[model samples]
Target: MIRHAVLAATCAMALFAGAHDGLNRWTQDAVLPPLLHETSVEVRARGGELLRAFPVEDGRWRLATRIADVDPTYIEALLAYEDKRFFQHRGVDARALIRASWQALWNGRIVSGGSTLTMQVARLLENGRTGSWSGKLRQMQLALALEQRLSKEEILTLYLTHAPFGGNLEGVRAASYAYFGKGPKRLTPAQIALLVTLPQAPEARRPDRGARVAQAARDAALERLEEAGVFHSEATSAARRTAVSSSLKPFPATAFHTTERARLEQPEQAQILLTLDAGLQNRLESLAASHLNRLEPNVTIALMVADHTSGEILASVGSAAEIDDTARKAYIDMTRATRSPGSALKPLVYAMAFDLGLAHPETLIKDAPVRFGTYTPSNFDGQFRGEIKLREALQLSLNIPVVSLLERIGPERFMQRLERAGLQPQLQGSKAGLAVGLGGVGLSLHDLVTLYASFAQHGRAVTLSQYAPQPTSGQRVTASAAAWQVGEILSSAPLENAQLNHGIAFKTGTSYGYRDNWALGYDGRYVVGVWVGRADGTPMQQAFARSTAAPLLAQVFQYVAPQIAPLAPPPPETLIVSNAQLPQPLQRFETRDALKRADASRPDIVFPPSGARLAADPELPLILKLRGGTPPYAVFANGEIKALGLHSREASLGPMTQGFFELSVVDAEGRATRASIEIR
Candidate 1:
């Protein structure tokens, strides 16, 4: 009789196994494939959301793109509370099932679930529990199928990825971040307990909806963990005493514009790792917000900070308010928008001048009124510092001196050098003019910051990168010696608030019509750029760079002071001298009339040697070298008096329009020599 009973039980087990296999086989083709390919969650950047393209048909339920690995402690607690024999069970725990069945039979109703973690994952994949007996059977078959198809880790990942955790929140990571404003990797014991209990009855146990219920559920999980010896009794007691968060916290929203741009550029990608530092980005956004609040309505501020050596944009705030009704077009990213860059380009001009041996730091340059044909450039204050050292003029941001230097360097050539160094300055017309030295040309804040970073990089122009480290090797923008000189001069400029002394070499610019105010600064390791203006291109009254942008620039530096080091020492060849100690040619950066009286002798053209072939690319400047010239001489290009300074034997006859032009030099003694050059 015992043998017959055993035979009957064995045959029943065999029939049950056959039924489960048939059910799994029938649903494998219809259900398993779709479950495997759920809509992925949005891409994230530096723990911040970058993009979300959830399918509308999915009821807007938040789904994870990928499951964040669970902390082992949480996993331990989870299994202790949910399924004590999860690892030993294939999909269902037979012992737990028997215990549950006995309790249900005794109570005359269901008391507890016998579903293992894999079975729970299967139920979640099918979108929550179905109370019907057939639904339970289906879940059991699917769980067994999942066990055969995936590894143990993959099964756990599916549970942690798809488990509902109250409202729109799903997954352990999302729940932790929503409740505690952090990821799940370093969760508190209470946080782990809360996460472990939420999925059982997510809506009823939502902390935000019913704090008492949530805490009770968490305490219950903790009690189970304590009973299982996974958590100590004292720790479980402490976790139960801790209060659960009753409100959800917002996730990080750093570098919003940058992340959006990355998403648009690579829409197919589900994640984008940017070089941005989240902490720094948050501080800058806060800084921008506070400053914007103090400014006029609709005035937006854009700022960027970069590592000079790596050329990584560590922080970027595209605008004060990315979306707002008061600020028209507030969504515009000002960092890349083309706007006039006023005197911000002057330092580069001075660096170029130093690179070309045109002037030194102590070289005296006139900041008086200077006329270039119909355009006469004057200092910002309309007052001249008649003859100031080039260093002092740059520190003072004197306009006329830079325009004069740009004239000597040739505006077109200056622009070409910039382009070669990875800048794209926008000129008003096809031709560049002297006005470019004073913000006459439009330049985005990004390009302006990149150009300024060259100074900190010892004259190398680093390409700005939003993601990953860029090549350290960069195009040489100027001589290291020249860059050092410029850096020293700028560093010496008086800070707007002199009490806060941070050794930063910085420059400011107010664009034409006050449409933009810009400040670019750098220390040893970092470069920061700031722009303040209205997004609608309307001028802000009295919004000068020194008053508006410099203070903000200085404040940004203060926030990052811990990361900055002193600038590198000047190159050995860099000249550090007083005004009186400069070379005769460097003593005064004079134009035609500023030099000493010329000698009574004829000056001969030594370059483009009378009949030389010259390319008239309009972009190339004709540098005329003279011989036998006096202390001061007059140079004429095509009958137009190009320049008056003759201290040096060379003069830059600005880019010639493609045509035959006569170049003549007249000495103070009235002796003249002429050369005819053709531009082909």
Candidate 2:
């Protein structure tokens, strides 16, 4: 019995030693998670780290560099302030832990954190941001292993890459440039100190507070430096004396929100460079702000501008308000909302007619109301102008003639024209009733600009791009004939306001009253589209005049005109005409019916004599074109039922079915000559 008891004691001692050795091995072999991971834990950890890294709100990262770009001084400052005696301690920091435990016990609360930078990294690695003791134990175990596996520099780099500085910013590199607008290397002593203090309190040191907070931060940092002996007396004094700037230049708050949120949540790390011009974006925002303040309170505006030649978005204002975290998560997206495009669809109708060989710029059509298949389209004023040239119809934006033109072109072909112009319709090849000519098609502003830009570029369809690194997604649209016709209509638009000095070609569309009010047009260089209406279904009772969206476009044109070339000359086939050339009959008569009636009453026939004398002069009219004037079925003395046909080659008075006839002779002077004929 005594020997058995001794054996049990020996085995228990061996088991404890093996367990301790196994723990040591684990401590020596651990490393942080891979820089990139597909698991949810890694994604959340990486997202949190990125939010701590860049100038972002959600997932959109705009940073161009990484942690290595930060200054060594900032690194040292962070190390000294956040974790003093960091190098001397093993992974656990037993003394610091004991001190923290005693303090917690004495206060009956956890007042101070004993976890080092390594522990924080480990916490993120194993259990993320959970607050349980089980998680803490795992974090502590992982921290010791990380310290044993990686050198101090590697650990520092990982911390620099993962630390959240505020907003959507991650790491010291992004935080350094984002907050200070300079890289880590350029951070002043005060700036470095501010960064070190940020890991402790990001909200209190937000850069938007401008110089005042910046100064307060600098003062605190200088004092800390004085305590640490890292700064000279002069350095500390200069740093304290420096003024902090509280105001940052205002940026377009909306697009930035989108970009920031995308950086935070998007799985694809492929960087996004926006096509928005910072300066123009600010100007557009200012315009909307001024206009909305004067208008009703609920009105919101969305503006998008594109380079007609390249389809690159020069400026885009998604909304007047900033898109914050809640908005991003809820997907209250301003960019994707569908809006009605008012009279903006007219040019496409005319373009289709030209392609089908049915019309020209000078084609005449009555602007009077006509019924077709139970649909009647009316002009904006609900009145009719008896007869108008096609040019006049379009220039005045008359609705009836346009509707008639669309009918001649057919609905399917018209939709094909729109598709050819780079418009991705939500529904294609629908029955396009008369309303289509009046901007009846529900399209987005993005689609409107694309179709308009095709005309502006003389029919070359440049693909549209909202982000930078332009997308080559736009298929080459616009058949050559359609392109030529649309180009003419845009160039000849009449300007009601003289303040609009640029050669602007545009279309103004209003859907009913104010459900959607659009002014979409282009100069030789840029295509600008403005959509104004309520977020909910409501009408814009205002007309499309100088006071509304027109002036906004006028402003854009006036500013951007010098950058592009003058309006190109209209296509050669396009003709300019007036009411004088387009004559209207006292009463409308069908050309086919008029000819049929004339054929029945006058049936006198004439024929060239069997061996008639041919005139040597090609300009001279043929003699005996006809002789005996008689009734229907009567023939000339030459034995023909009809007079010699116009060219002296065929007889017109042959049968009731043959119809009436006349002769035309070409004179040497290039003039036309006619001959009289008689039937026997």
Candidate 3:
């Protein structure tokens, strides 16, 4: 009777296997070689390449990766759960199946599984689960054939190399990283056991969804590990108590997220090095955080920094919101957001005038109110200086002179110059007015920086980039002389006064009423532009660019300047001064070499005897009379050579002015300096 019962059980198993084979065929095609084996070599190769490529769609790559290429703990964790007895089994585990069947029979329901890893692979190759007899036969046939065609190690490798875990994820290698963000080889024991439990019902046991059944299954796997004497009591308890991971952000899957999206999918590719330096990124983020924290609720800040010469983004802080696991999108991208630049546009307007040969940094212009037709340009302070050099006008951020300069350059031509300087003008055409110079046209901080980059690069206009593929050259915006002039203005005026303390050149810009404040400049090297305030059109009271943004920029420069080489000024010969005849004040002082003992109240103004040329190399000791409050001056020859300001005298200026004596006087305040020289 025992023999008969044993034979009966064996026959029943055989019949069951046959029925399962038929069911499999009913659902999926039960071809001879199986889908994978029958696949073309090209298809297999393509699959391997696709797996290797791991293309990023939208913002998300098909899988997560690290610089190391693989994490071993993830592998161990997956193996621990998915196929603990994988090595011990051949194509099938008959004893385990019998025990599972007995349990099902006793429970009156199908509550267990006995399929080995190899059998699972057979099922996958044969396609969807089918309970028909033909399906069972085909699965068994494929399993036996695979066993003969490949060694046990090969079979295990194939199974591990090609199992599905999540969306479009195939193979343990892909699934381990796709879901856990690590490689199978880098998985910890707990992580491995967790992954092992996922294959039974991936959706039902998804670690990210906080599924209770999945947790229970994971606990069961831990128990099995404990039974195998592989885990200590503390480890088992820890695994049982561990909570499921909740972070599972879907990487963006769109074409616009990368340069690859810009091109059609292809086979061959090249590695691209970006201008986005990781260290600079970290540094900028730290700076941006301080600004972001101070912003009002619902307000956001957008900022970007670029290498002016190479057009690389040294740092980019797109928005104030912290990046979370849920999403990588920002509501406000200052890099692209466009708004009226207000006084920030002044530099470009001035640069255009410089390009036209219409103005120089020393060009004297009235900062007083100007009326062109019905339009009257007002100063920021609601008042103006009667006469001020172009540099002082910019340093004080005076509005009238910029309008005058813009008018001199013609509004239409000014717009064209902006475009030439790499600014993308949104205006369909020109609108003639004074308001234009006061930040009339809408522009982004990104555009402003690009325009400034032209000035920074000695008048070369280059396409700005956040990512650098390779070094590229930019078109020349203006002659090298004009370019040097622009750089000189930017280095000294608004930027100089703000960042000179830290050895940087920077400009500050604020939209009307502080809606947006931007500071962009370069110190003979990197170009950094910052935009302050919220995305929504809420106004910040007087959010001055220099007050709000330049300080932070100065801080960044201070930190980075030590690592960079110091920037030297252009040769003195590059500076051209016109309407530059020696002033009578300097000529008067030239005749009084012996009047060194004059009183501070008022020194006698004497004229040099007409054509009475002093020796080409004069040894006259000119007295520099200084009041308790007034400053002394150094003289220059031909406005290009610095005459020694003999510092040994009680006054700061010495007899160095004797060689074609030209008096250059700087006030004690150090804010204003006056120069006077006689033409030889």
The candidate that wins on TM-score is: 1
> lDDT of candidate 2 vs native?
0.58
Question: Over the stretch 344-410, how does candidate 3's per-residue lDDT look in tens digits?
Answer: 7777766666666566666667666566668787887788788777777777788877877766567
| Number of residue pairs clashing in candidate 2, backbone atoms closer than 3 angstroms, sequence gap of 3 or more or interchain | 43
RMSD of each: 9.4, 11.4, 12.8
The per-model lDDT (C-alpha) reads: 0.77, 0.58, 0.57
Per-prediction backbone clash count: 5, 43, 48
Q: Which candidate has the top score in lDDT? A: 1
lDDT of 2 by residue, 59-100 (tens): 633343334667767767776666776787656565555555
Higher-scoring candidate on lDDT, 2 or 3: 2
Which digits, one per residue and each the tens of the lDDT, describe model 1 over residues 348-454? 89999999988898888777676777988777687876778888888888888888888788988888878867888887798988888888787899998999888
TM-score of each: 0.80, 0.63, 0.62
Task: State how far residue 465 of model 3 sits from its true place (Å).
Answer: 2.9
TM-score of 3: 0.62
Deviation of model 1 at 252, angstroms = 2.2
